[model samples]
Target: MIRHLSSLIMDNVSNVKSFVLLGFNDTMNFRVPLFIITLLHYCVILFFNISLVLLIVLDESLHEPMYIFLSSFCINALYGSTGFYPKFLSDLLSSFHHISYEGCMLQAFIMYSFSSCDLSILAVMAFDRYLAICRPLHYHSFMTMRRLSQLVCLSWLTPFCIFSINIPITSRVKLCGINIQRVLCPDWLIVKLACPEVKSNLTLIVYIFHGFFIIWIYTHLIKTCMRSSEDRVKFMQTCVPHLTSLIIFLFVMVFQSIYGRFDSTDSSRIFQNLIAIELLTILPVMNPLIYGFKLTKIRNRILTSVYLNRK
Candidate 1:
């Protein structure tokens, strides 16, 4: 019997090309309201992130390393947000919630890659601030435009390649179930559908690597910031925005992980979905604003841009 079941499971895993997402189980009265609110939220995310990107690109005076990082940061927000919003909106309007195997993998990749890239960019920003304050003499030569371009590319591509490896690992898994418990196709929920023995090790390994990388970067950042009042001030001026975005992102992820694992079953589907998506809703809109308002160059450029439009 066991041998027969193993063959059946293997056959199903290889042939399955779609998943039924159960995360959007809502009553008729609430779906339209939820859809409208989500649409507005997506639009707001795009407006703020894109506006910051444009402001950084157009103003020659603001083309320094810090602003360049912030622009990439905004562009990343757009990239990540796009991965989730359109499909979600479509599901909100649809009577059934289903995603093709390839589509789900692509979404999962975008979601995880976006998260990994966010931290990678933040780490690069932290490094930029460190050299600017702690090693000011060499900052210009070290952070030349060409080097910044390389760092930006690294930030974007490294996480992508790292996370993309999960697809094949997942593809090999024999799923005993096809029902995803959430409104979205999150990486973990998909893994949960796999047979009991397939232990989603690849996702866990990538997360561990990302954790070590973040710890190393932040340790150096704190160490350098402790050296002198000037260094501390520089850290405060430049690193604070990056730190804020990191904290908020981590907090949301932690809360969602905890909530989904331990507390979500008793909760309503809508509330559970909210918990799952809190990071998506907040980070894309907030990061650009946090950097734009806190950094003087970006802030001044924004003010000037507004003034010019008014004139």
Candidate 2:
């Protein structure tokens, strides 16, 4: 009887070739407007992130550890946004909101890696700030070009590798359902469709560890800044943007998590959809604006370039 049931489960899993995203079901009347709005938003994300990345790469005066990390952050934002927006915009116009099994897995992988990479990069930025402020004399010796390259690579690669393992495990699961309630396929939602129990504890543990590490680093930063006005000024200029990005990220993530746990029927579907896409929409636009205006070096370089181009 167990063997027969297992075969039935396998057969059912084989049958689920695509997932219907019900998040857009209620938006029939507003699809055109949503499409235009989302398109403009996506364009802004691309423009802001890409322009920042280019500005960093082209300008030699901005070649510092902090700016480099900021460039990486912008690039990751672009990477994550690209994974979602094209398909999203396409779906907004199409009558059917279907994603292939492979497409769903790929989207989930991109998003998971993107999120993990964000935390990792932010943690590295916090560490960089800690070193710059707390150990100013040792900062140069500790954060050499080679070391900076390694940190950037690890920040991007580690998350990709971790999620590479995760997506395959998810692929192997016997799925009993073909409907994903969200606008995009997140790993947890995929796990939710599985016939048997599956736990993504590793992601949670990694995120929690990064969170605590950033907090610990900031605690030391606060104490150090309290003693020296110079250090305090540095903190306000550099760490403020990092902290703002972190806060925005954490807020969106926490809201999404809390919203996911509650019954979907409790909230309006439009509100649910908004919550679902906030991470992609908010962070990409906000981070660049925050850093572009907040960092004196970057801000000045941008103005100089704009003034030169206008001439």
Candidate 3:
């Protein structure tokens, strides 16, 4: 029996090419409907995000700091959505829901970094709004195009570099199992599949540092917005949309995190899948919608472009 088990283990090591995603319930009769719903979700995500990104790029009139940041936000939405949706939708329709080891790592990298970068961009936007509202005279001086470009790059690159830490750690691990419990490769899920020695302290500190930085930025924005009625209006006008998006993103992240860690009971698979996917499904739509409708210049530009295209 001991020799047989050893052979089995060696066979698994040699033959394990992909992981089975156990998030879907094979007994469920709604796979077709589920596929349709997920397909529409992807379509909406692509429509809104790509439209806004094009709007920002084409309209030189909207080339200010806020719009530029909004463009970055939309692009990241596309990035995140693409990471999840294509594979997810395909899995929903397929008989076998499996992802290769390399594919799983890539998905986790994109998904995690997309989220972290979203938070980073939001933090930068919050700071920019604070400067524009509270220190109006110096806003232009401080947020010059060159500096704004640098901030944009920081927002994009910082999270990419931070999340890349996990890839090496995960790669070094000798995975014991070839089953991932989620539809997509979330970092935590991927990490869990690895051997026990992968210390998560560094990743934890990176997350904590990111959270604190975002909180600190918002704290200053709140303090500054308190002083003047005019600044209050600016905050309500611009920051409110950002605040709304931030709250939703944070809520989705927290909800998913909780469910991922604690909820192990054999419950509803559909509900499980929904919670796992809420962030990717929700944010791509929410970010572009909030910025598109709430920000006057973007709205107007979109309208003007639409009207002109009709002509």
Candidate 4:
């Protein structure tokens, strides 16, 4: 019985093309206000992420491997926001509800590509921090500019290569039957709709997305806690921000996974929508807040820049 069910899900479609996304809802009631709110949030995030990246790149003071990784993630964040926001803004202002199949696929690909890059970069940043704090002697030689540049390139390239393989698999399957139900046609939801031998894709994605990141971050974190003899206040200051970000990500992922698995129903659908908004909108707002307020370097940079401008 299990085998048969697996076969049913795993079979690849031979023919058919294109999909029509149902998209959150067709109601006129909530579209305009939601659109405006989403636009404002995305603009702020884009500006912050891009400005930070530029500042890191231009400022010789911020030229370390740590800042390099942060800049790379900032670029990914910009790409991530770009993939989803323009469509959302258009949908809100113009009431353009339809997306071409090509458009949807491209959107899904870009979103996940950036997201995957960000995830890997975050892991790399954590490792960089571990090396700096826990193994300070080796940090300079180990994380040089040349090496950091290579790592940044790899972080960007890795997702493009992996997603290129998986996207072709998705392209082979037709989306004629299933309808997407979100403002952004997220890759996860799109893959679920594509009738492919999807176990391989799902398994790979889970490994990359969930498995690697969770293990990598926490493992280093445990090592840091064990080794650090620093004052409690100093230790907690760094630990708390990363810990909070991780908790929020885990909570959202857990709920979203459960919501994805549930049968298509109104209540389940509502829960998923709520989760999506929080993941996209609320999290971006919190990220800058966490990093800006918690990290001394970032806080001092902002204050110094402000003071210098005034002078």
User: Which residue runs of candidate 1 sit more than 4 Å off their true CA positions?
Assistant: 1-14, 201-227, 260-264
Model 1 scores worst on lDDT over the 10 consecutive residues at 1-10
The parts of candidate 2 lying over 4 Å away from their true place are 1-11
Q: What C-alpha root-mean-square deviation, in Å, does candidate 2 show against the real structure? A: 4.3
Q: What is the lDDT of candidate 2?
A: 0.89
Question: Which stretches in model 4 have alpha-carbon errors above 4 Å?
Answer: 1-18, 24-27, 194-217, 231-239, 268-271
TM-score, cand. 2: 0.94
Could you tell me the lDDT of residue 268 within candidate 3? 74
Sort all candidates by lDDT, best to worst.
Answer: 2, 3, 1, 4
lDDT (CA) per prediction: 0.79, 0.89, 0.80, 0.66
lDDT of 4 by residue, 137-180 (tens): 89899988788888888788877888887777676665434356
Candidate 1: RMSD to truth: 4.5
Local accuracy of candidate 1 as per-residue lDDT tens digits, 17-122: 6777777766446889888998999999999988888887888887899889888988888998999999999998987777887898888888888877887887
True-vs-predicted CA distance for residue 296, candidate 2, Å: 0.3
